[model samples]
Each structure stands twice: as structure tokens, then as C-alpha cells.
Target: MIGAMWKGMSGIYQQDRGIAVESNNLANSSTVGHKKDQITFADLLYTNGGMGHGVGSQSVSKQFQQGQIVGTGVGIDVALEGKGFMVVRSRENPDEIFYTRAGNLVQAKDGFLVNQDDYKMQGLVPQSRLTSSTNPADTMFTDEFARNIVSTNISNSLGRIFNINAKTTDYASSAKNDDIAQKGDNYKSSQSKINDVDALREDYINKLKEYQLTPNVPEISSQAQKSQVDFSSKISSLTSEDNKLSITVGNKTFSVEFDHDGNINQDEMEKLYNFLDDSGREKYGLIDPSSIPTQDDIDNMPITTPEEIQAKADRQSLRDNSINAYSSAKSLVKAMQDLSDKISAYAGYSSSAKSGTLEIEGLIQGKEFKISEVELNNEKINSTNIQEAIKGSGMAMIDSAKEALKQAVEKADAKYLEITNVLDYADLNTIGMTDLNVRLDVLGLADKDVADVEISDDGFIFVKSGDNKFLVGRLSTASFRNEQGLNPAGGNLYSQTDLSGNPFNADTMNTIKGKSLERANVDYGTTLTQIMVYQKAFEANSKSITTSDEFLQTAIGLIK
Candidate 1:
């Protein structure tokens, strides 16, 4: 009776614990990234043969199955679709690392990415500090920004020098202004200071070229070419008969010939004017007849003034001194652009050349990857000739393209350094060259506040401000060999234990970006059913104890 009572008591205790576990699961069913908890029961040791022991709680385990991933439409919110947890370190205690499926992240006051508990998220360090790292994009951007600063500085300095020279010349020639003497004194001091800076012009240029700043040269040259107006088109549109010039603007065409040799041609000029007036060309606003120069207007115009002449002469002088600098800069940009174009063309060709399908397990084939075999047209001589003219086997096409691109870029790079020397000697140069406006979207200025942040599927974090986009860091994910072995270390984080193998970076494909979250894996119906079953078992165990007590009471009464 005592053994039976003890066994019933054990069953009651175990069932009560089982009920608690089910209740906890039901309570946390709505929690984000929550995993369901399961309680296992085991039979206790039996003493004698053919005798069973009461049930006892074995262990409480977490179900590590995947949770529901739902979209939240928030930029920083990330959800793991597969088996991985985001790695985070306790902000207050940096050495303590925790893994979590809960990705409700926010930027803390210090700009570190943190979860809801303010734990700092672990990520790859920003690439900017790793200068030796092999990131081609980073290299390109650093070079571009450096060159931008140098070029802007050079342009401003040249402009300042030009203004100073113009003013000094005017002061020396004629002392018209009252402040001329004071200005002269200032000019002397400014000129001395400028010359000192000018001495280092070579050094700045060398630094700019050392960065290999050539990405925008091609684009700038193209814009410059477009800005050069074509006068030939206008000239071609004009119809001149005898001594009259006729031009069309919109739908109206008017012809007028000037006969200024003071002869019968005057009558023709008059006749042309009468015809235009009769056609109502001036009244209808087709053309302004008065704007066209009459003989009187031409003769009455003032001759060039001494001031104007002086101005023109000064401009010519400036141009003469600076032409070499301008030409050199222009040449460098053009070469860089040309090289860039060739690289793009060859890169495309190489891709096309290698795109053809090949049999992997087939026998040896002759004339593999022949560019001649790839054709837009069968009869085109140039197309066929290019493949023949290219000196190498078909397999070498991509290699050849890569080599050409590399050489072109390098040659342009060499010429870039030469520009600094040219600019050093060209003292009177003004930066009259049009702005390149190279849109290097990757570069960001330091100390600028971030406008927005984005997380990519590949775990790269990008921060943007206006036109600038910065690569801040890369988010890292951790995966475990035995995920269930992870212990719940409060605040929705898990701690690694001996049972779980050391964490490794999660497979790349497991991470999903954008505004998404993983929902809890708890099943309400199943938990509710578990609670009911445990409650019934608890009542039955209590009844068995009650029955034993009743039987003992009856035996005591019989003895009485």
C-alpha cells in the first residue's frame, strides 16, 4: 500500500509539471520567433521483477522546427527563412555573444545596429578601413573621391589666380579706383601666397593620378563633344541666291540679300525688304526685320574701346598661358574615356565568345570556340575578317580581350601623371573646362548623416544620403549542427552549449532581407489538448491515492 501510494504521488507530480509546460507554450504562442516547448515523461526505476514504476518528468525540450515567415514591410527588419540565427553581442558586455532568430533591429544612439534588447548585432567590419582588401568597387570609389577633391581644389585655385592677375593688370595700367594702392598692396601679398601653393601643384596632380582617377574621363569627353554646337546644319539650311540670304525658322522661309557695294544691289535689298513686309513676316512675329542690320546701323556701331581691347588682350594672354594645361587635361580625359570604351567592348566580346554551349563528356572536337563560327550574318566580310585578324586560337579570345583592356587602362594611367607636370608649368591656366559630373554613386562623404538604410539578401548593409550610397557593413548569420541543443538565454536569444557544435556562418541562401519576420511555431490546438490530457491524468493519480487511503481506513476499522 505504501509503495502504491508513493507511485501515485510521483505520477501526480509529473503530470502537474506536464500541465505547466503546456500552459507556458500556450502563453507564448503569439511571441515573434518563438519556438514551442515539449515535455517528455519517462517511467521511473522499478524495484522488483514484474512491477512497474510511476511516470516521472524526463526532460523539457525545444522544437527547433521552422517558424512562419511573414512580411512586415520595414527596411531593417530581417527574418531567417531557414536554419540560422543572427549573431549578436551584448552591448554592455561585448565578450558575451548570443544567437537569435528575433530580428527586431534598430540603430542605437551610437549608430550600432541593435536588437530590441539593445544587444549589438555582429557584422563584418566596414570595407573602407581595409585598404588592402580586394574589393574592386571600393578601390574604384576611393580613387574617384580622391581625384574629385584634388580637381576641385585645382579648379578653384586656378580661378583665383586668374582673377588676381586681371585685377593687378588693371591696377598697373590705370589708377582709376580709389582703393588701387591698397589693392596693390593686398595683391602683392596674395600673389606671393598663390605662388607658394602653385609650387605644390605638381604634387597634387601626381597624387590625383596615383589614385587612377579615369572612370569619368570618357563620359566628360562625350558631353563636351555634344556641347560643341554644329554650325554646318544651320549653314546647310540657308538658301542664298545672287546676294540674298534666305533662312527658315519653323514653317516660314524668308530670303534677303545684302548689296553693300553701294550699287544697283541697293535696289534689290530694298525690294527684298518690301517683299518681307508685304508677307507680314515682322507683324506675325515670324522674324524681326528691324533686328537685321541696316547700312546705317552697321556704320553707326561704336568701334572697340581701349578698355574692351585691353580686356580682349588680357583674355588672349590668359588663354595663351593656359592652353597647354587645358589641352593636357582634355587629352587625359579623352584617353581614359577611349580606354574605358575599348574595355567595355572587349568585355562584351569575350562574354559572347564564351557563351556558346559545349558538350562536357564528348570526344575531342576540332576548332573549339571559333569566333568565326559565331555570326550575325554569313556574308559580312568585316565580321568574318575580325576573327581571322585576331592572332590566336579561338580559346584565347577572352584572354586576349582581358589583356587589351588591362593595357589600355594602364596606358591611360601613365598619361594621367603627365598631366600634373603640364599643369605645374601652365601658371595662368583657368579651369574653363566643363564639369565632368561623373556620377560615382558608391562614394560617401564622412560626417554626413545617413538618409536611409537598406539590407540586401546577400547580407550587405548600405546607407544612403542624397546621391551618396555607402557600404556600411555585412550582416552575419550563425548556424549550428544541433540546433535543439541551443539553450534559451532569455530575451529571445540562444546560448551555445557543449551539446551543440560550434556555430559557423549560415549558408548564404538562408538569409532574406526587407521588412520580414518569423512568427512563433507554437500550435494552440495541440497545446490545449495536451493540457486537457495532463489534467485528467493528474485527477486519476489523486483518485488512486484516495482509494489507497480508503482501503487502509477499512482495514484499521476491521482490526478494531
Candidate 2:
């Protein structure tokens, strides 16, 4: 009777525990990155005679199931479409790391990552090689990582733009600035004073640089013939008291300097500096008809392409022309060699005054003769005659050589025009050289060309961003696990958790739909089904308890 009582009592306990576990799971069904918990019951061990299985405590085991993502426009709100747990700091104190599926996250007053639970988030600090170690901070960003990411262009609606650069020791967030990209914590070199070694090395390097400067090195002109207004270069710095002439010549800008008084030597620098307007004439939209040195100016100078001066060329062709001329000349070389062989025989011995049947490869010395198969007599012969044989394989070699020259001139003139025509455009020295490469260089090609971008500065961003030929938005995607585990704090964001794993930050995940958020993976139908099961299990356990109590009461009554 006691054994039955103990078993019945344990059953009730298990039922109660089961209800709690089910309730908890049902409650968190909407939580982001939340994993579903499964209720499990254990049988209690019994020692009485023919002991029966007695229910122990019911416990819930969390499932590591993945969840779906819901898209939201919030940039900070992250979700995982895949498997992984986000690491979060404890709410009581964020320093302590704890794992949770609840994606509930909030921006803590501190700039570091945080969730709605006010738990600090943990992510692997990028490893750097400033010194050298496997440690994350030791990891240096690759050029690709340095890409400027412009999240949004400021519309008429201006909001706080935060510039967070992982490059510095501190994180800075600005409320509202014109340029967010440049607002990050400034990263200055280590403050350790320069030691003897550093100073000495620095000085030595400067000396070497001075030597290598070659300021007087003749500029390698890529100009083609017929180029006018032979464009040269001007050197200047903005800090040198010079009216730093950052002029955009033709869609390209170049900076030049003058003197300490912010004045330039008019005679030497005026053309490169004074020619452009100070109001960013070419670069900014303020000017009408930007890009000086139009196409016409190139046609009249020492800067024109070589073809423009082909009429003046006397010796031969340029690089490609020379190479081809040599090649064509090679094709005729073998023919010339054969003619020489025949001519040598004829020179050695004419038809020998013997109509003895000689086949004549050439006519020499004003005598027409058949070749009597002359042989080398180990004696020297005039090379001029041999050359004539090669030309037309007829009269003396000298005469034949003359004719070959005529053919060569004719063939080369035509070929020269064709090849030089193409090479001329590419040559920077051509008279009509547009200096397209330089144009790009001076026009801020390096700074203006960007992939993903954000504009936070004054109204300048929206206007400046559209000026260049940049792509729409950088392709990107974000991934997370256990949508239910995620605590969908307000803005589509889910905090990190042990079960959910860390968020796989999607920077151009090669997915579409930028400025949008992924939807949560929670299935409403499935959750409702789970709810019904939980209710039924609760009801069944309740009945078991009630029945056990009544049975006990009967047994007690019988014993009395």
C-alpha cells in the first residue's frame, strides 16, 4: 500500500513538471532564434516487492531546430537563416558570456554589440598582424575589407549617422554628420617615441627616397606623332603656401603648388594652375563645359600622334612596323639564299665557252651561259654580285639589289599606315593624345570609385554619391539560427545565444533586397499544433492525479 502511494505521489509530481516545461516552450514560440523544448519524463526506481514503474520528474529538452528570417529595414537588426548561436553577455552584468536564442537586442549606451536583454554580444575581433599572433586583433583587414560601405544615402530626411570603424582602439558614434565614413575613431600610429633605431632608419630611408626621387628624370612620353599641346606635368602641394591648383583639366584633376605666400610663379605655374577656376569648375556642377584641352587642341602640337608626322618619317616604321617589316623581309630571305647559291656557281665558271650544255641560273659579265655546274674554288668573290642574283636572279648582284629596295619601300608604306594607326591611339605621346588615363587619375578616380556606400555628411552625400558611376547597392545577406530563440526586440533584431551560435554577418551575401529585412521562420500552423498537444498533456496529467488521490482514499478507508 505504501509503494502504491509513493508511485502515485511521484506521478503527480511528474505531471506538474511536464506542464511547466510545455508552458515555457509555448511562451517562447515567438522569440527570435528560440529553440523549441521537448518534454521528457523519467520512471522512478522502486525497491518494493515486484516494484512497478513509477513516474519521476518531467524535463524539457531544447531542440536545435533552425528558424526562418523576417526582413526588416533596420541595419542593426540581424537574423540567421541558417544554424548558429549568438553569444550574448549576461543581463545582470554584460561582461559574463552567456548563450541564448532570444534575439532580443538593444544598442547599449556603450558602442560594443548588445541585445534587448542588455546583454553584451561577443564576436571574434578581426585578427591583426600589427605585430604577429593568431589573436583576432592581430588580424589585419584585407583590401577588400577596407571597401567603403555606404548603408544609405541621406534623403531630405536627415538622421543620426554612426561611423564605426574597427581600425581604432575606440568606437565613436556620431548623431548626425555629413560624412559618416570619415567619422570613425581616428587611428594614429603607436605613440611610443621614435627611438634611435627608428629615427636613424627613418632618416636613412628619407635619404634613399631623395636619391630615388629623380625629380629631373625625363618623363616617359607616350605621345604619338601629330599630337598638339604636348601635355606635361606640374608639381604642387596645398600646404606649401601655394594656391594649390587642384585643377581638373579634362574630366581629370591635378594639384600643383607654388610658394609660402600662397602664390605661384606666374611664368612657370600659371598655365597649370590659374587656368582652372577655384570653385571646382570641372569636378563640381558649378561649371558649364568642363574638361579643358578639347580634342581640337591635340591636333596642332609636338604632342600629336606619330601618324600625324608619318609624312616627316624618313628611316623606317615604329615598333610594330619594324617588327613586321623584319618578318616580311624574313619570308624573302630563303628565296634570296637560293638565288645566291645559283649565282655563285654561275660566277665561278660561265658556260665555260662550252655550249657543253650548262643551265644558267643567272647571266653575268655580259655573257649569257648555261650552268656548267660550277664549283667553289676556295677563292673569294665579290659579295655584290651574289646580292644581285638574289634580287632578280639575273644581272650582277648590285643591279638586282637596286630593284629589291623599290619593292621594299612600296610594301612598307602601306603596312606602316595600318599598324601605326592603332598603336597611335594608345601612345601617350601622340599629337592628339587625350591622356585618358591621366584624366581619370586627376579626377579622383581612387576616392570617387566605390562599391557599397553610405552618406552621412550634410546634404553633400546624396548629391555626391550620384555623381560617380557606382553600382546600386552592394549585394549582401545575413544568417542566423533558431528564430524562436531570437528575442525580436523592437527592430527586427535578435540577440545572440549559446544555442543559436554567432551571427554570420552578411556583407553582400550575394543576396538581393538591400534596405530590407528577412522574415522570421516561425510556422504559425505548427506552433498551434504544439499548443494543442501541450493542453491535452496537461489535462491528462491532471486526471491521473485526481484518480490516484481517490484510489488512495478508498484504500485508506478499507484499511480502517
Number of the predicted model whose lDDT against the real structure is largest: 1
Candidate 2 local lDDT, 1-560, one digit each (tens): 45555665666566656656556656665666565556677776656775666776554545555565565554345554444444554557545444444443343443333656565555322111112111333332223223221111111111112111111111111112212221111101121111211222232233223323332333221111110110111111112332222211123222323332322222323222232234212221212222223233434435267865662242222322333322322212222222222222221111110111111222221122222222112111111122122111111222222222222222212110000000111111211201111111122222232232321111011112222221111111234555444443332234556665545543222222222333334456765676576567557656666777788789899999
Model 2 spans with C-alpha error above 4 angstroms: 46-50, 89-95, 100-105, 124-560
lDDT: worst 10-residue window of model 1: 160-169
lDDT per residue for candidate 1 within 1-560, as digits (tens), equals: 77778889999999999999988888877777888888999888877796877888788988877888888887777788877888888767767888888877786655667889988877653322222111233322322332211221111222110000000111112222222222211112222223322222332234334223321221110000000111111222222222322222123332323221312233433333343333222221222223334445444545489876665555555443333222222222222222222221221111110101100110011112222221111211111211222222221221232233222222222111110101121221221111111112322323343446666565555554444344455566778888888999988899999888888767443856557788888877888899999999999999999998888888899999
Which residue pairs clash within candidate 1? 218-337, 243-257, 244-257
Q: After superposition, which runs of candidate 1 have C-alpha atoms over 4 Å from their true positions?
A: 129-446, 467-469
Q: State residue 5's C-alpha deviation in candidate 1, in Å.
A: 2.0
Top model number, TM-score: 1
Q: What TM-score would every model get versus the actual structure?
A: 0.48, 0.33
Residue 57 Cα positional deviation in candidate 1, in Å, after optimal superposition: 1.7
lDDT of 1: 0.45
